[model samples]
Target: MSIGRTDLNLLKVFEAVYEEHNLLLAGKRLHLTQSAVSHALRRLRELVGDELFMRTGKGMVPTGRATAMAPALRDALRRIEDSLGVEPFSPDSSRRRFVIAANDHVTAVIVAPLSRDLQQAAPGIDLVIRPSTRLDLAEQIDLGRIDLAIGIFSQIPPRLNSRTLMSQGESILMRKGHPAARRKLTLRDLTKYPLVTLSVGGQEEGAVGGFIVERGLARQSEMFDRRALEEALRESKQEPRSRVTVPHSLAIPALLRDTQMLAIVPASLAVALAKSGDLVRRAPPYKAGTETLRAVWHGRDAHDAGHAWLLERVAAAARAAEEALG
Candidate 1:
């Protein structure tokens, strides 16, 4: 197709459809009616001479040709926007919607405060939080569906950029009156008492090298350092037994309320949960490695004024969380 014959607006519709996989949702994203979006799609399809998307029970699935065209089209659109110059972002007056991806723990520690800050500084803004633990996180960011993601990522592709939010190691949590809560926990205590740990992905999900890789981005699979725990268990000649392995960190308080189970979790989460009178946080018996919480976003937004403003608020919230940890 010749560039002179193609309407640039149609490319925007195509990108939205390819990212959302639903005509109505794509139309909402592009601020167009469904029929208008469909008309644009029809024009683009005729210009490209391909069935770009197939309507299915699930959604609008992209055809092979559409999939092949997506990456370049997205990059080119971003460049065009940059060249055209974005409007000044005034947080006090701009009514904008931003979507972010973050897991439950990060939602609790960082996003919670960020929301409060937004209420005061940018009340007209809306924030939509999606799960960062989804397997297709990188794909979502690449498509511009997610403004940013907050989590621990092992390897980030060059197409994306990241900034560390907080750095923390592992800590153990338990009921205040538990038998072992009176003293410092030892390696033997890990095996003697039933344990509960958080794990988002495991061997069944192709989790290797301590993370799960998708679309060239590697996200942390297990929250703790499994290698360190296993080594410690070997040295003590004790078999490790986790009575409960869960994915959600917020449930730890209820899980340990009246039980003997001890939970190994991120130090920041442990600190937040331990604020309640019933739970106490302790340093892990063995050397639990540290992990950095980072906010990742597409490199194309590096200079976008609105995106930069949101990231600054995110950093401020992270600082508050760090103070709470201390």
Candidate 2:
């Protein structure tokens, strides 16, 4: 097992394949043809005397050996790049593509502004947004497929770094002319009016407390504090009733339009949707706790020029969105 016997370039191919899980995609990432990628993978398999990856219907599934070697190898490659120094990132000319993970709520509230800023500042750069609510979100970030993730995460693994983008509380949304729209939201209204709430996953999906944990990362499962809501309901001697339970924030406006159903959602999202003039945002009667939106990324990208630029742009967009709520 001499280092001299192995072509270092082949390791890059392996890294791309491990991150992408598709030979064609790996080839695209490295600017190589699909056949060339296959050849490099074959050479590496022979050099290591093990089948590092197996072609399957879903994608190239990595073997146990490949999984065990991934973290260290990826970190070593990043270190090598750092030592050699990468070209300075020029936002005006670079054609680099950045992949971000976020739910529809963040996409509407934060990423929409970020996209507009990128259009003017870096026209050639491509942006791709994936759903952060996916169960494999942690794995995707760890594998380098997603450059950044924007969401409310309770626990982040030590290998990843996170920063708060904004903090928001729950707000009740209703149609403009609804019967209760003119008054402040109260506990009696909670039991009187039918409600609509957001829940991405529930106890059936292994959600504990109010979060769903995967790969040592915890994301909020329930957007609002269920305990606080229930306690307020108990004081009224009534039970909370949800007329509609939806998984997406974008669907709230439609679900409440021309209906009596009231929706409880993040204040930022409520403000964004209410701009259409059909909906209105109100503070909840109870002290609904606030949640902080955060941007999370791998430690390997901490010093990368392109990543830092994108992060700054995202933070600016978040700040703008937060200010609008005031």
Candidate 2 Cα outliers beyond 4 Å, as residue runs: 20-28, 51-64
lDDT of 2 at 122: 99
- Model 2: clashing residue pairs? none
Candidate 2: RMSD to truth: 2.5
In model 1, what lDDT does residue 43 have? 93
Each model's TM-score?
A: 0.86, 0.88
Best by TM-score: 2
- The number of clashing residue pairs in each candidate reads 0, 0
At residue 278, what lDDT does model 1 achieve?
91
Question: How do the residues 1-326 of candidate 1 rate in per-residue lDDT, one tens digit apiece?
Answer: 46886789999999888877899988887789999999999999999999899999989999989988887797787778778875467999876678899888899888988999999999988898999888888998886778999999989999999999888898999999999999999988888889999999888888996799998889998988889999988988887778999889999999998898899999889988988879988999888788999999998888778899999999989888888776
lDDT per prediction? 0.88, 0.88
